[model samples]
Target: MKKLINDVEKVVLDSLTGVQAAHPELRVDLENRIVFRGGTPRQGKVGVISGGGSGHEPLHGGYVGTGMLDAAIAGEVFTSPTPDQILEATRGVDAGAGVLHIVKNYTGDVMNFEMAAELAAVETGVRVEAVIVDDDVAVQDSLYTAGRRGVGLTVLLEKIVGAAAEEGLDLDAVTALAKEVNARGRSMGMALTSCTVPAAGQPTFELGEDEMELGIGIHGEPGRKRVPLASAAAVAKDLVEPILADLDFTSGPAIVMVNGMGGTPQLELYILYSEVAKLLKDAGVTVARNLVGNYITSLEMAGASVTILRADEEMLRLWDAPVNTPGLRWGA
Candidate 1:
């Protein structure tokens, strides 16, 4: 209820206004609610784009730039972008090579993006492909998704696939790499507290001070279980264990992320990260590169998610490529 906004209905547009002001290097389309990498599209490079509801800042929108997504569509908070909005982004970002839609596994997102892809191909003759990120090991079906919900692994996938596209890979190659990244990654999340969506004017869910929700989704959906609040180490164990179980990380060097769900602070995130690292090491999982921060978040929710990607040489090389974006920038 204590949100900083002028009006509930205008929350998304108002936030987009701030995004436009804060990141001048990017192009913001207020009407369509799309954010694009400023300037002309790369002639031969595949255009990489993703989108989802608002609230998960630094996600689809914050990632639009060099070595990452070329454009990102912003829907209403926790809502899917309409097919027309998605088609607009697809058409705008498409150069000669084609466009890649990196959609999460949410049903609404999946359906809308599919419809947009069909429209773009038939109406505009722009080749479009999509990769659905379903790396959450937490649940097979949620209120919003028929399969596992795409969570933190989305950030990692976007960076790697965007690097491939920036390298001038064809649409087919870029899409393949994206699918590979999605296949290799697994994520699990936990929440210490719930968050209030701006329009709702109240918390999405409530959690007792002494309890925590394990295997939580990014949109405040019920997690796998609620249990007594535990230590960082115990929480890390609860998260990392499922991911390790779902995918084998011991085969090769891995890319790991301990992402905050908006409201969690860095101090606590590092504490949790250290414990996660310890667990991975104990399991003989070799971590090559790691990111620890709030790359993807669930608006003001106090929690964290762990994403592990089993990486090979190509993934590692692409991951090391320079990226320039508001949410993640390095080497550029």
Candidate 2:
């Protein structure tokens, strides 16, 4: 329950204020908690808008910039944004071409974004395409329980899909690329500890110092099971093995990201990545490119997730393309 904040109700607004101050290329709506690129609504390009809860920093919001998302709406911590907020973001960023909504597969996010897209079609004639990322291999991908959670792979999805849109790929092509990216990626996470949600004012779940949750989803959801904590190398094996087994990333060159879940330290993440690299090499899988850091996170949770994307030349080309954002800036 220890959080440094003036008020729980003001967390989203204060964060938005700080974002505007730090990133002048961005515009913030104080009342609506919507973040827009400084000069959005490009005459012919597709408008890319994405949002979810506020806890996952650099997610829907941090990706807003010249080469990524056009706008991002923020919801309460770990809660989905309202339909009106999403509708506002969609309509505000819509240009003549169309708009794309990068929605995570969480139930609340899906429902609210779908509602907003319906409203947008009626009100503004904005053709909206939503691509849900369900790259977490922990979930069963069943017809129940919200399907799979969108974890680390959403970052790669936004970057690649945004590039396609920027190149005038049209709505169908961009959407196809997005779906392809999602389908080709798989992720798995493990948490050594739990986190407090600020507004919830308590730990979402409990874990002893020696207990680890193997298949963790974001937002403190129940993992596959709890077991005694293991070494970094062992933990990396557990996380990466499941991801590789679920997807055939070994078929070709791959892009890997050993992402920390907000609370894990860099030293430990690298230790884990060392093991991941060795394992891939042992399996005859070529590591074309890799990112090891906190790209997507569950607020203040001590854990990490490993994502592997089975990359073709086109995907790798987009991955190498220029990207400029507060959280991730490179290649440009």
Instruction: Give the whole-model CA lDDT for all candidates, comma-separated.
Output: 0.94, 0.87
Instruction: Write one digit per residue (lDDT tens) for candidate 1, span 1-332.
Output: 88789999999999999999999999999999999999848788889999999999999899999999999999999999999999999999988789999999999999999999999999999999999999999999999999999999999999999999999889999999999999999999999999898888899999998999999999999889999999999999999999998996657999999999999999999999999999999999988999999989999999999999999999999999999999999999
Off by over 4 Å in 2: 141-145
TM-score of 1: 0.99
RMSD of 1: 0.8
Clashes of each: 0, 0
Report the C-alpha lDDT of model 2 over 1-332, residue by residue, as the tens digit: 77778899898888899998999888888788899988888888888888999898878789888678888999999889999999999888888888899998888889999999999999888899999989988877533237788889999889888878877788888888899999999999989888888888899899987899988888888888799999988887898888878897547898999989899999999999999999888878888989998888888999999999998999988878887888778876
Top candidate (TM-score): 1
TM-score of each: 0.99, 0.97
**lDDT value, residue 169 of candidate 2:** 82
Cα lDDT of candidate 1 equals 0.94
